[model samples]
Target: MSMQLNRKYITIVFTVAIIAFPIIIGFFMLNKVVDPEEIMITKTEVSPELITIQGGFGDSISKYHGYNISHHDHSLFIQIKGSKFPIRGDKDFNISFTNTYGDIAEIYLVGQDNAKRKIWPQP
Candidate 1:
């Protein structure tokens, strides 16, 4: 009888631990996934005249907004605000906008010139 009771106690403890472990892990994971702020923009237009960027993210320490332009495209416009560093062009020569919070967005442009043209016409 003593042996049976001990076995039952062990089984109960093990079952409770298994159930609690998963609940604890899931709680933390949900917090992490919900913590990151996200902003989405749809339908933006760019022309040679000016660049425009629009987005908002919560949290000052970890929030930013930017746009990405594709390689070798010159007809693209980019603008950003509230960023720690200046926007960088990608390897393909595309424009990229990033925020201070490490969020990045890109736009693809074509028929843009990245080449340096001569001021005077070639004779």
Candidate 2:
């Protein structure tokens, strides 16, 4: 009788752990910071007058607004505006800046969460 009780207890504990471990791990992973390279750039339009880049975070539950563009020498610093919310679906963005610098060798997309990624001249 004592052996049966101990076995039943152990089995119950193992079942609970199996069920709860994934839930705990998933919760932590959801809150983890997103890497910059994960930011996907889907489309880019480069012209002599304007530079337009369109992209979004797939499977991200964050709300993002317009971009803030700053040009320095041969690089363009583009930062997305907005914050993460308890929402669903992906967020897309359209950013355009004047092509006063002529030719851009590099482009960086900075997120509101401080994630920075290079989107142009992909290597």
Candidate 3:
């Protein structure tokens, strides 16, 4: 009779562990799902024409200037007046431009990487 009770107790313990193991794993998986900081923006696209910039100069320049913008992974490609320029970023960039006589030009730059800010002053 003692042997039968010992076997029953062992079976009950084993069954409870089998059920509880998945529950414990699911609890950890739920934490992983709820974390938003783990999410990343794999790709981003911005149209130069669609962007809004403050100040009178930015508004006037955007209204008259034209640009072609493209981004792939960490690299940026910009084309204007049959010339292309490439830039790479470990984070993000805010780009703007101005055209003088449709020949002479300037590119404004604002960028951030790992929370460090940089601005390439208007030229």
Q: In candidate 1, how many Å is residue 4 off?
A: 1.0
Candidate 1 clashes between residue pairs 3 or more apart in a chain or in different chains: 64-99, 67-97, 68-106, 68-107, 69-94, 69-95, 70-94, 71-92, 71-94, 74-112
* Model 2 C-alpha lDDT versus the unseen true structure: 0.69
lDDT of candidates 1 onward, in order: 0.35, 0.69, 0.31
What are the per-model C-alpha RMSD values against the true structure? 15.7, 9.4, 18.4
lDDT per residue for candidate 2 within 6-50, as digits (tens), equals 999999999999999977765544444444555567887777799
| Candidate 1 structure quality by residue, lDDT tens digits, 1-123 | 999999999999999999999777754432221111232332343444433343343433322432333332323223222332223211111222332322223342211132221111121
| Error of model 2, residue 5, in angstroms | 64
What are the clashing pairs of model 3? none
Candidate 3 worst ten-residue window by lDDT = 55-64
- For candidate 3, the lDDT comes to 0.31
TM-scores, each model vs. reference? 0.29, 0.56, 0.30
lDDT of residue 6 for candidate 2:
100
Ranking by TM-score: 2, 3, 1
